[model samples]
Target chain A: MKSNLELVNDCDQFPPNRDPSFLYRFMVNGFDCPFGYLLEATVNTFSWPDYWEINHDGKTVKLLGSSLEERNKQIHDTLLAERERGSFKILKGWTSEIFSVYGPQKDLVLSIPRIAAPLFGIVTYGVQLLAYQSDTSDGAIRIWIARRAKTKRTYPSMLDSTVGGSLPTGETPFECLIRESAEEASFPEELTRTKAKACGTVNYVCRTDERGGGELGLFTPEVQFTYEMELPKDVIPTPGDNEAEEITLMRVEQIKSALGKGEFTPANGCIVLDFFIRHGIINFENEKDYIEISSRLHRTHAFPTA
Target chain B: MKSNLELVNDCDQFPPNRDPSFLYRFMVNGFDCPFGYLLEATVNTFSWPDYWEINHDGKTVKLLGSSLEERNKQIHDTLLAERERGSFKILKGWTSEIFSVYGPQKDLVLSIPRIAAPLFGIVTYGVQLLAYQSDTSDGAIRIWIARRAKTKRTYPSMLDSTVGGSLPTGETPFECLIRESAEEASFPEELTRTKAKACGTVNYVCRTDERGGGELGLFTPEVQFTYEMELPKDVIPTPGDNEAEEITLMRVEQIKSALGKGEFTPANGCIVLDFFIRHGIINFENEKDYIEISSRLHRTHAFPTA
Candidate 1:
């Protein structure tokens, strides 16, 4: 069986040999607020737009649009042009939904198309909720697991958390969790609002490879605000949207088996492992990599966060 | 009120201006396994014992003793001599207990006196248990807080976790927690063993200043195996030993106020802040530094851990 640490390593693949010189810092507001990294190749070959400035000496790239709306339009036009030229396959999954980019002081710098985030090596945010039921008699816990629809663009047909979604530009994590709960799993809004407990966050710096269905070698630092909801026994979750194909309640052992067999999405695997650690299921006594796994789940990002 | 992040920064004072060249890597078994960092001043000025080798060119230091016993003895004798000379104030609080030093692959390389751990800039392990009670009707949570004895050497009369103790060389975290739970709080072994849940770990790299009651400018990277226990309302904790002078149950708001006022021990403050975050008392929407605090609580240590 694959160790929990191994499962974590599979997702948090920040290249160890990454060279700072080979990547350009994504600066905002004329300050040294670096929030993303852009590959040298992209900097050299991509068609130059008037609003983007590349500084060779400083190894930095900045948007020169003077205002948020102007910057957003500049990026949108650039990506649209790139899509027409078929320059990057990742742009094929264009998510018009914008993701807010924050500066070093947690100020909203600008918003860009969601799919374009990885190209700029920007940090993204999401929310995930693990809904479970407790059998009070024996104290056995069963979790509700969802399988992504085969038609989904990313990680299609993969096992996922019961309720998970990306945080749109202005939405808070809790708000996203509530919306995802109803939209993805048909979970009641009142039940989720009252019962969902915001536990903590899970952070990892991942690089997209071919397996991730993106342009390879792009950094995607993510912060996931995690939550847990103890569902009542009488409540059942069904597929509320086409995003999920099915929902099933699995015992802890079954979940562990699935995790060991690498059946879950990489990030979801990390979220579930974190859940196991917090609930005392996988602890220092039994898990040799308990310390390493716990620390690795919350890696300190090199760049500023929202 | 001090921000939670500011409270965290108080305990995790890893010198931002730390010059790595001024520190020597502690090697083991002829490998470049750097488990600790020793200041160059200590290397150049201290009396050289035959068992310790300083490689100036490689910027490394190693224990030349052939066996674990020999290595342990070498460290013990050196510390004893230093204590006699009154060379380091940290040696005054020397506990006879030994802490295991691990290599890069997590193998036990040697054992050193507990108090001498910071002298070598080694990573130390401890277990902290936060005992709490939940009101069934209103769902209000209250925590049991401990106050150290006024005569204690380190942070005397300061607030502390309900049960906490260092991990001796040969003991696991859980084993240490169980022993400390009974010895420190007069808590029953059965209740602890059955109810204590190993939630996760909190890690930080701190440097001792005058306020910490140790030799100034010594590095202390620590890993705390944190636990949570829901105590029965009828059960009360009394001082089982002189380490803790008194124990009292404080509501969550009271604990937060204490944390804001910096009444708890620095490390204990971090542990309590972690508890608040995990229990949803401190969350993303309400706290501005939610992501930063969550990630900082589990800082990635720069050395190997056992």
Candidate 2:
């Protein structure tokens, strides 16, 4: 058995870890503070109440205590005082913390870093479509697919769902999906709860063109919550030009096949597909073409376990 | 189930949370760069990163980003690039985070928050001492009760295992326990792997403090790890002033009875004692005096059920 340090260090030694363009860079960092938005920060090492003075542009902020006792004491006192006074402070301040709009922020691929500080950051949430092609000639399950405009800052020329965004501060998993759906695809709020299929959070991290030492921008750990909104046979994806350029209705198999073939670099969408396949949202096993193309797109290999 | 907004708005409605006067308070507010020194500061809820902007002079440092995402992204990018380049850039500045140290600066209370952060900050790990008064009157199995100090912040003036800290950042469960033991009791390193017992993480939140709101610091989410240390009859607890002030030996029955009577304040320890009694670490049934006293201490109800 390896020491925790050894194991973490070894995992860190893996090369793909250093890749700045890696889509899931931040996932390696553990834990997160789920505020309205996800936060990725490092819990400072050392006992609490332990202070380290950092010199910024000058004015000194005394970094103070670390002991849990001290913290709990303050809380206890504050609560007690508030109880006696029958009044407590309501915290409110507009922070200059950096936040990014995901799902085609610019004309290029965009993503948030997974870890920073100690325990805070952002995560991406996306809806995964699972509409399949009906055998009936006139039976085509209308599925919405939004395309990334070439001018996007990150993940340029990629495909993604209509409703997706970086989770907002203090938004729950379900709320984020609903908000993204309305913003990106203009999906009706009614459809949010009706057809809203919460797949799961796909944990990943990535960097953006906004470079700082090429250092990873610690965003909230992203977990794309895939929601399936089954559309009428004629309903189509009408992506807002500001966020997306094209709306295409392809057979779910085609999307899967393209993804498997590595034809589309939908960084976050791949995991959503995993959810779809795992949850039987889209069945491809029986479709020979879909399976073949998928194998070609995503060359998955399974090794026998002895 | 209530909505998230409702939950957040109603958070204050719940008996106020315990922030306590631990060193982490200073760090939590924005003490940049950590070093070894106890800091003293007040606990206040600032929007996540906003706390970083707070100056020691009580002036808010101007933050670079306007939102959490922006701030986190910038920090993440910088860290990653630095890591990739194998050079850590000193964030050029200081956030006046304060903390205070009590007792021996060596190893006082195990820095559990640092450890718990990595473990999702939602889990608990604890150990229980099963002490007994064996038939060997000539030579009793001297149970080394790793005594906790009274004045040491957080659960000050209470009893805790000498070797218990929350799992630290980048530490495994066993590693945390081992580190706690070595730091607190100066237990041999080898003993970490040897006779040291792991009681496992307790999955619960404790609002056991009764400080009311006078201090604004009381609640603590703890994951306790209990260990049974067999002390040589001659070796009594000679606690260092910082972590533990004294080591008092209570008969097994005293502890069990204390637990039964709910006399113990930081109820987590009481639970551990009960576990110890049940496991024979402490023979409550046999040690009538211990039971009598401990029962007096058992002031609260049984382990709270939600």
Per residue, candidate 2 scores C-alpha lDDT tens digits across A1-306 of 322212222212221113222222221111121121111222221122323332233312222323434433432343344334533111121132323322211121122222121122233333344332234366534345667777775566666665556544345546666666666666677766566544322333333223222223333223344445556555445664467777677665676665554444334344434434333343222322222111111211010000
**DockQ of candidate 1 relative to the true structure:** 0.84
How displaced is residue B249 in candidate 1, in Å?
1.3
Model 2, residue A301: what's the lDDT? 9
Candidate 2 DockQ vs. native: 0.01
Q: C-alpha displacement of B27 in model 1, angstroms? A: 2.6
Best TM-score goes to which candidate? Answer: 1
CAPRI-style docking class of model 1 based on DockQ: high
Candidate 2 TM-score versus the reference: 0.30
Share of native interface contacts recovered by each model: 0.78, 0.00
* Over 4 Å off, model 2: A1-142, A205-220, A261-266, A279-306, B1-306
TM-score of each: 0.95, 0.30
